[model samples]
Target: MDYLALLSETEQKKLLVNFSLMTDSSIFLLNENKELIFSIQAHNAQEKDNKSEIDIVDRDDANKGKGSISFSPNQKDCQRLLKDLYEQKVPFSCSYGHNYSLAGEPLIFHNNFLGVLLFAYPTSSTSIFTSQMKFLRQYLKNLFVCHYEMDNLSEEVVYNYEEFSLLTEISQLLGGILEESKICQIVIEKIQKTIPAKSIAVLLKEEKEDYFYLVAAKGLKAKRLIPEKINTQQGICGWITKIDQSILINTGQDFTSRNLKLIELIATQVGFSLGNIRLSKEREEILLGILDSLVATIEAKDPYSSGHSKRVSYYTQALCENLNLSEEVKKELVISALLHDIGKIGVPEDVLLKPGKLTPEEWKIIKNHPKRGLMIVKNINSFHNVITGIYSHHERYDGEGYPDNLKGEEIPLAGRIIAIADTFDALTTKRPYRKAFTVTQAFSIMAKNQGTQFDPHLLDIFLSCVKKGKIKKIN
Candidate 1:
């Protein structure tokens, strides 16, 4: 929701002032981005005098006219304290001396972590003072959540059916449609419904390009004709592109302030949508790069399993497509399949490469791979959605699997899909102990254990796909 961007500098300052006055403690407010929005001294003159006597510089006074102050928690102890507060998303207090105590509360709005609000106070204060402050913090958090929700509701209520419809159309259009020209057309058409203009145009600047190209335009008279290419210094659109601002010119009729704000909002959304498209591509590339590196490392350790993960990923994706899974589900399945065997990296080389039957102890070690893979990827926030698949891919349909014996629909869909793909590849591809099986041989083996080892329904779909020549081969 871009919580930090929603609060104006003045609003932040006012909040700091109110917090200081109410708590009688010096306060520091930092946005979720860890940027210091502002700080305020205690409203108590006696405390201010005491702080002055101690020679602790009041950054608040020094930056009175500034929009925001960039103050780092330079001390290692303070830094660690802030890190704990951020990670825990809870209020914490620490004492530096008999009299001095530092307390921090994370500011949250609508379940979104917005920032941290730190209070510096005297430890000698009454217990009631601390309790009252805690109550106030809770009150503030609830107020912020309510305020944000009300603001959103107010925005929704402001729009009539036509206005709401136009916004909805634009939002849906911008969601997955990344083509710049198409997006510009949709945005312009939506805006035209609300604003009567002689002409409306969308100009975009390409990466590393010096000029803004007019991508979409409507209702242009000869006198109001826009140039095909606009210089960086030309026109309102050029200036907007140059500085990333949304400007509106009122020429045809008296547009309400709400209407103008809507135009600006649409412009801002357009810019954000374009930026997201680029970021999405970059994120996909980075995800693929990480997957390749991890898969390559796994393949390197097990020489006979080269390209095994990739093939599993391909097969899993094919199975997902055949099942008519959503794009998001297919993406996670592919990632989970590529790294399904990643836990084998932790198994002893001898255990992994053994050409004969393993001892019970060695087999146990092999089973620990899923748990190890979970540990390896658990810290990565992006992998949280797929970690279940990595950890439970070996689980059986009848609850006989390792790590967690989740049965039937209790198992995550990604995990269930990967289990089929993993077993299929293992049976069809030559492992150190066994020769590769033909497609028929693999299917027959899998079908025999369908209700026990695999989801019978998914297995049926997979076998049907293989028979139809949709999935070519395990390799």
Candidate 2:
């Protein structure tokens, strides 16, 4: 409905300047609503245009080259005339005052009234066909309608691009995330940013609750504002309500059904992400329970080493924290440390409980525990990759430790990290053959063997933790 929206101000000014020089008549543009949008006034028409079809008398003598005529319409009368022209919905020419006349043509395209183009000029003294203005009327009418359609198409393309960008960002964010609140926050924020027409929010209801509660909201305004809690509902409550979870986007001003579709897709993604997070959490708890029972079995088999696996787990976590490892890596390493010595179950009780040093035969059986532990956990779907630390915990950093003799850094990162924790706990805890070494004595022994027995980098992190008194996870 707005004519200026399709035709820019700079373009309008250029049209006015060029038309004034060419036609020397007043030209005006009006919207379908009968309001004047742009205009240009040119007074001395007969001198410049030189259209011989006009039968006119100059107001001055022959010495005065060509006299000028100025015509300005009264405000009330102009509005009334434009209203009548708009209502007639057809091309027309009519006299306005004693000397001036108006000609108007409707810019209609595909049965839609786009706007009106008007031309005003002084009337000739004698009646004439007025066919002289035919070329000017047709050209101006076509140009105005052409510009209006082009602007409409440009707006649609821009809107579509914005919608695609918003959906892309939201899709990437929802992948692999396990937080309900984070999903809700992303959905609401993205919808608000894409098309800032109406206020948007994600609301959820718990099973026992009667009403759905607000989670995140973008405020309602003439323009989109920053993300905030106008209703103050946050993500703490749980999943979204079973019914009535839709985005509020009024489709009148700058919105349409396309915007509504975008919001719907975002909400569906949020719900799916929240559901997956809850399901993953439940599975992890069950899996951890089964692993706990295995740990309990290992502790019962060797009473003196009842808490050995737990202590190693504690040390491994401290090293992970000191190294600033990601949470996923840290969790895997902790689980590996707990099950590292499970293969020791296959060793004879006599050998395990011996109060003195073992012979070469007994030592050979003792060295087989790492491979034995690997064999035990190899089939577990979740522990398949996790058994790296379990199988390689005893491997020497310099390619001298065990089974495969894998060298430094060839060892998996989990293997390198758990080795330091395993050795530290073994030295400080009392075994059947030797009394407990003091904490200082344990560190002194391990420090002498860095790079040969442990990853030098991970070793440094563990030793630093001891210095900082952070090696303190307990069962």
Candidate 3:
């Protein structure tokens, strides 16, 4: 660690002041490159009174008017002494003249030479100096090492704290999002805040495609670069995408290993989030295809209701949109509508295709279709939200409905919406028992049973939709 680089200029000056008082000799502190950072002249009552006997000269004063001082030996004797000290890598003493003596010690840490600590004094005062003065010089050297080590430790503690804080913040940000593009964007933003970089990019492999595309980027013109898809066998980003690793490159500066590790952690998190989203979407598509096939089977048995399930799905979606339901809830409603009549497959063809009024027992068998539909999809995890809607779509709004006799708000909102759509589609479509009713006739019949057969608020919304020409009247 470079202790001088870690310390402020004020701290460096304070250190030099303390050393000057302790050594009773003028002090000079230099960097590893032999650049003088600070210098102080020792001034005490004893030194002032003995000024006549010792001619003290401060080399720094020669270039006081200049912004910086350059130290070089002008004499052959001084040059030889400096060379000897450097070769020995230890402290040594030499005379500037007959009266002045200078002692210098090489400041080394971890076997690396940092700079030198030099002290100047008068030779006439050598009789006053005893073994204690030599001991003081050694003590100062050890003290400097201790101070530098402590400074380095403090800096390390601060760096670790900042790293922990940054990781905590990024983890929280990643938790609230699910979209792959949004996740990539959030990761890149957090990285920009945590580290200094000229540019950052998140490359993601397109589904079933062999190349990676730039999904998110910062500080770089992405519009032009993103169009050219990058091959996984190409550059650093491509290599990282192939191996799921992260890298840091600095053009003219060196970054710490910790910074690289943090970037890798972010990349790993983004990759995991994207994988989960893609898997979920694939599973949802499969479930939707299954529902569509089941609906098709139900329609095939009854030719008059060829497009009944599709119409109910469209109506339920329109109702959900008017109610301002979330996308997730709207999706669930659409699936429930598509599979609402799926249980009719269990009903006998004679009763299902009867052109006359159904007997009481035949009517009871038709009501059992909802419960049968529930049993059909009960084992599927994705159908959890639609199961209740399928089972209760035929149940009346009042307590007079069949099966569970669920009353009022006791029915799921999805079940209630499907109930309206199912009735509306049945009334407007030509059935075995009756010809298709006109749009006004269907609405009038539904209006007569508002509070008893349908939700009052939902009924009003459906009526408003009819008036606005939003819901197309089926022939």
Highest lDDT scorer: 1
**Model 2 vs. true fold: TM:** 0.67
Task: Tell me the tens digit of each residue's lDDT in model 2 across 279-313.
Answer: 78888888789788888887777888889988998
Candidate ranking (lDDT, best to worst):
1, 3, 2
| Model 1, span 1-475: residue lDDT tens | 5555544445545655665565556666677766666556553412221123321333443234232222224444457768998999988888755544577888776578888876665556536458778667676767667777888888778665656677677887799876788888888877776776556788777667788788899887889787787787776755675776545566667677777778877877788888887787788799889989999989898899999899998999999989877778778888888888888889889989999999999999999999999999999877877887898898899998887778888988888899999888888898887799988999999999999999999999999999999988945
Q: Judged by TM-score, which candidate is best?
A: 3
Residue-level lDDT tens digits of model 3 in 1-475: 5555533255545655555555455555555555555555555412211112333334535224222222323234434645665678787877655444566767776788877655554555444433445665576567667877787789878977887787677667767565777888877887777787667777777788888787888787645455558887787756666776556566664566777887776666666778888888999889878978898899889999899999999999888889978888898999999999989999998889999989999999999999999999899889988888889997778978877988899988988899999899999998888889888898999999999999989999988897898877664
Residue 39, model 2: lDDT of 58
lDDT of 2 at 96: 51
- Ranking by TM-score, best first? 3, 2, 1
Model 3 scores a TM of 0.73
- Give the Å error, residue 273, model 3: 0.8
For each candidate, what is the lDDT? 0.76, 0.70, 0.73
